[model samples]
Target: MWIADQWKDYEVIDTSDGEKLERWGDYMLVRPDPQVIWNTAKKHRGWKKPNAHYHRSNKGGGEWEFFDLPDIWQVHYKTLTFRLQPFQFKHTGLFPEQAVNWDWVCGRIQKANRPVKVLNLFAYTGGATLAAASAGAAVTHVDASKGMVGWAKENAAVSGLTEAPIRWLVDDCVKFVERE
Candidate 1:
């Protein structure tokens, strides 16, 4: 399994009782993680007074209990910027673990002497897409969900890549690939 540890804006502070304590930017959050089956000691300070805690419901969904938290926020990973909001399913509009992949792909793009073209399928929020564009590659970001594509666009603008060479498309990955 590839675990992304090279992150400056996000960190897993601790895990306990089927929950993971994470810090996104300056905000600390406690969210349920299915993989956290071990009952470890929650010794971290963030575990006790997190900015938000997602309380799971036996009925299938969950709700976030906020404590002095903003409705939305922004976080940075190196030169990339992402908007974060508490939404259904307790997502912060990003998977911070993907930072490692972004760095790896960006490095490869930079090393290549010629112009690189990237096709990001199922490009949720366009993290990799923006990373490639930021690394001087022309990128085509494709996602089935329009809302996610819009979110990715917002992230791109926030990262000062609004003028970057990116083609945003809201289409099924397979259909888009077949057309290309």
Candidate 2:
């Protein structure tokens, strides 16, 4: 299987009992992952004293339990920066695994001599949009949630892409595409 393992800010420290111990920057987190079906040995020290843990609820949703962790933290991929926080549904507003995709997209945009127009659907925290903009592409970031769009805008601003050609749109991607 192809692995997206080139990460400077993220790592899967260990997996055990349907859970994963990961390090996001300097903070360690324990969270459930269905992909980790193996009940392996959890000998990692991070597991013993994680900075945060996302407890999955049997009813429907889950909650984050914090231990000396900040409400938000920053991580960088190349020159792009992302504000991460343990939010609902066990999300830190960033996905380090998708950095490879961002790199690939940026490469394609740079290869194109002419101006490139990119439409990023479900643009969570503007990672791809920022990457496209950094690569000199005009990007339109779209997400159904207004908050997500706002977060993406924040990411853009932080990445020095605030003056770049980026439009944050809060619209259903399917409907937006149909209208387009």
Which number leads on lDDT?
A: 1
Q: lDDT at 117 for candidate 1?
A: 97
**What is the alpha-carbon lDDT for the whole of candidate 2?**
0.88
Provide the TM-score for each candidate, comma-separated.
Answer: 0.94, 0.96
Question: At residue 26, what lDDT does model 2 achieve?
Answer: 86
Screening candidate 1 with a backbone cut-off below 3 angstroms (N, C-alpha, C), the clashing residue pairs are: none
- Tell me the tens digit of each residue's lDDT in model 2 across 1-180: 546677778888899898999998889999888888899778888988999999999997899999978988887788888888899888889877888898899989999999899999988788889989999999999999999888888888788878999888999999999998
Residue 113 CA error for candidate 1 (Å)? Answer: 0.7
Ten-residue segment with the worst summed lDDT in candidate 2?
Answer: 1-10
Model 1 agreement with the true structure over 31-105: per-residue lDDT tens digits: 999998899778888888899999999998899999968997999988989999888887878988888789889
* True-structure Cα RMSD, model 2: 1.1
Model 2, residue 146: distance off in Å is 1.0
